[model samples]
Target: MTVDIEPSRAIPAHSWRRWVGLTGLLLAEAMNLLDATITTVAAPVIRADVHGSASSLQWIAATYTLPFAIALIPGGRLGDIHGRRRILLISLAGFLASSTVCAVAPSMAVLLPARAVQGVCAGLLIPQTIGLIKAMFDGAALGRALSLIGPVMGLTAVAGPVLGGVLTSADIAGLSWRVVFLANLPLGLAVLGSIRFLPEDRADRKPSIDVSGALIATAVAAALLVPAIDATIPPWARLALVAVGLIGAAGLAVHMRKTRARGRDPIVEPSLFRDRGFPAALLSSVLYFAVSTGLVFVVVLYVQEGLGASVLVASLTVLPFSLGLAVASLLAGQVLLARTGPKLMLVGVGLLGLGCAGGVVAANLAPAANLAPVPSLSPWLPVSLGLAGIGGGLVTVPFFTAALARVRPHETGSAAGLLNSVQQLGGTAGVAGLGAVYLHHTGTPGGALAIVFGTCLAIALVLAVSATAMLSSPKDVGQP
Candidate 1:
């Protein structure tokens, strides 16, 4: 039987506290979203200033993602065991600290480690933002609250580039690229303020961390990501990385199996997978991100290198994706509420695939070793990315909503932990796998991009098929 959560019958006297909690949630969500893209616009400036290595450049991106990926489950599990609100407060405080460290770092070594710390803080805050929503609001109120998060995230994506560009150009207080990280300080403090005044949730018996499980999961993801990244290094290293990744995954599975038999909570419980729909949705998500993340990274490189655009100009040019995502997200929620979500998903995926196809076009038509960038191709670039944004907007919330619906009410926290872990894994894997494919194929300005985007199109098509199979037919969708 399905359990539909309903709102409290009496309007609480603590409405102010509830709003405070909501604000905190929003603030935390914004930080996580901002971190994801803020670096995209800052990378060029960072490269020039640091005289960084290729590995360092990749770490600038990967450090944040890897820790975020590994720690999400543990972080979510902590929120469930301890107080989510308390964890949120701690994370906000840590985020503030990490942001400051990032702002002052003199070397790539210092900066990348600081960014990893920031990612850990983010892992704590982001999942709890949603968990607290589930704890604080229910039924129709829950629906409204979930709907509120997307537009805010969409806005952040739009701001990431613009804000990053503005900071790099302005160099006020001699900050330069530091502004990207420093900007988080005030926002985090604001969230911390809200947490102090907000409602909170706690499990009476806080569970201990599943250290063995965590080690295994971390090892597996690192092994997989490291190998894909260093694919061209050596035959022996490639084989070793793959073997290690598989062993790590196998170890985690065994550890979790033992944890389940021990009658204690594991970081990622196998029970979450019993619903069947959850794994399928997860598989589709992994495929979807293979295109989305790879496209974003590659396209940014293309616009900057091929077009000879300044940091600000490049960011502005890429604005279409964020804008389209925001617009699509706002509209898709309302459409999905009426039983038409499947159609919108199809349309969104179609648009997204078309957008990836456009990237292929952009790459092929790029000026060849020319003195000037082709002005003609530049204008259409955003249009192509914007299409994917629209599709992304439609898919994100509904997919999460659908996935969460498949779990039992008591298990929401566990489900949240698991799903976020998988989401980050897909993102990390996308960059590693598709990125390697790109680097292997071409050495020109847009060469890596053309190959990466083609891979993206193929991945998108696979996701489209999966989404259609699951959502188009009544039999596959079942209840959730």
Candidate 2:
């Protein structure tokens, strides 16, 4: 539920305390971003140290994102029912604790559970950041605060891998890959200390939790994800899981209908589906993120395992992509979005598709080339990644603006939350599906990379075409 903060509840516009509180919220967001990106850079080192199997490595990433995606909608409702400040503080503390467990975990068995816990805490805490910002500032101040989010996110995207590489390569106190998880401790504490500046606020009328609906949704996601990621599962079992996911989806539809009939809000608003454009936007989002995120996973693995690059080199190799994305995002948000709207997103998709095509060429050309230095890596690879990153930047900001352009005010909160959830879910599916494909061809790393890039290229083309639905959406009524 969206907590519409009454103007009276907002901290005074001129107050310094509100700015301090915004710092804390941004730090919390950085912590989440850091953990998510940092792990990929360290995953190979972690697997080697723990003697983990390929499936275990995939689980390390998947466990966190899947649970995080499932928890997001419920997490927002939690903030509305409980005070946002209270829930945010509780969840932040939980995230730190889970990170500690992850840092010290001796095996994938222990680490996977810890990662899942961390994801849940992250999901619970993240939604509150926006809600609290709304409570703390309004008008121009709100716009300024919201504007800071994109830059902070862009900077974090660039920094996370570099920091992870430094920590892993430094082998600080012999912690090695564990240092990536351990690094969150000091940062989280700083954020926790600053939380006192935030004002407490909750919904005037508490919303009821949809426990069954949450469970069914979780089950559906798990049913679909597990079969895709786990190679050990027998063919019959995999098919059964797919069937279960389909059934669960049908059941969720019926359950949501009943909940709305009872005059209670469901985990997802059924009414939002009435718009043809919304579902198309969702599918486009899922496909775009799946390709983008899955490619990152594949590239990191390819450079390290295929080319025998050091952890630091692998991280640096991915740097240009992040830099391209960062620069493009700023331009798109401040300038291009207002002028081109959905057409800008289509252009972004086309670039990403071209990037993927380039990746396939690069993989086939330099499959066995020495990649110890960032400069020595195939030129096509970095150029491809940079192009993909630019495309990602263009799509990221406008997708939300266009998707929610037509949403009703009351449905805005649910629509935004679901969008966030699916993006995470898309990442999870990409890692599972694309990671599985790569794993199957691990013996031929170059061929594997080519195949993954080809797959991403196909998905990107489909996403570009499908995303035209955004064009059909009416311009946002609230825009100037």
Candidate 3:
């Protein structure tokens, strides 16, 4: 499973065309990121308009992410076989079509299915960005391009909620929340128009698809994700699903080894795990994202439900965090990372832990809600979140850069897919685990928030310790 760029079609790193192509890839990635959270603020409005059950509302969000996560490995393999440019274009087209359907959907039935299609397309599209970026850029150019990804991600996290609220409130064309889906159209079309600039690259030799391995992998992802997303399921059932996922993971590993033994390409190469840094990077990603995602979830709930703030105000409160993230990402990528190496990640973890401690203090200091129309949040809350975001920015790009550093050129697509899959799983786990902790102490909102932040701080400490041990290995140090 080695990819070779078509010599005639190869775009040079110095060419302006490559930058144009990179823009298209980044936009596509942003669409995927935005959709993941954009619907959160608008979910209530959507449910009311479509006459959807509470369960259906949950399904609306779950359907997109679950399929996206499940299809990632196979999607990356498809790019390896059929060429990244072609797959990206096809997937982008599908995403546009499905998003249109979502905008026009008159019922939950139509909307949920359309959202599922959008997720599948996003899965197929995202890996190609990483694949194409690696294919197109090298040296300092690669670092610069990769640096931009963290900022875009951080900004979009803020944009999703704020944009969703604004669109829904604006009630464009009297469509209300449907406008959120409609918003993807212009961005999608702009990227679509840049198709000609993208380089075509694929495997040197076509390989048979590992049908058994793909199915097993999808099943394992579903088993794990379904439980995490749908809290309505009984505790015993969720545990059973987790057990099934673990067993399936074991079976999938065996199947991949057997498939590779028979001289066929498995969905993921077994040899990738032999890279000690790759596994350590993956572990760090899981820990980092779990805390980050969980912290966001808890903060949003606390601001709105606990503090009795309006949705708009709640969304606005997160703005400082995103701004801090954007600033820190640029600093790390442009200046700090090239000189500091893995040591920078430790600094990030320490800052994040300190921010979490601030969050605990802020939560304890929150004023009790009164009958006033506008509720007041503690000043320290935004400051703490911003500090945490800065830490997140510091780690995000370096983590991706480090994970792929030791990977062979041929393994970029698969490695990118696996890294992304771990991220999604980590986020889901964080939401389920931390959300439960918050819910348990809902009667005491301040106390619940304190507990959540304390938990995040604890996780940050553990991640710092693990990262120290991981980076101490000679193989893992100063690679990028």
Top TM-score model: 2
TM for candidate 3 is 0.88
Model 2, 65-138: lDDT tens per residue? Answer: 88888888999899998889999999998999999999999998899999999999999988899999989988
C-alpha positional error of residue 366 in candidate 3 after TM-score superposition, expressed in Å: 2.0
lDDT of all predictions:
0.71, 0.86, 0.79
User: How many residue pairs clash in each candidate at the backbone level?
Assistant: 0, 0, 0
Report residue 319 deviation for candidate 1 (angstroms): 1.1
Clashing pairs in 3: none
Error of 3 at 240 (Å): 1.3
lDDT of 3 by residue, 1-480 (tens): 355555565677569999998998999999988997787667656877899864554466667876777667787678878899999999999999999999999999899999999988998898788778878887798888986777778778767877876788788889888889999999999999888888888766676778798789878877876775565789999999999999999999999999989998888878777766677777887788788866776676677667776556666777676676778888997899999995788888888898999999998898756334457778899999999989888877577766776777757656777888788767656765676678667457878998999999999988887677556545633233
Ranking by lDDT: 2, 3, 1
TM-score for each of the candidates = 0.89, 0.96, 0.88
Off by over 4 Å in 3: 11-20, 44-60, 105-110, 131-151, 199-201, 368-373, 408-410, 440-442, 474-480
1 or 3, which is superior by lDDT? 3
Q: Which candidate gets the maximum lDDT versus the true structure? A: 2
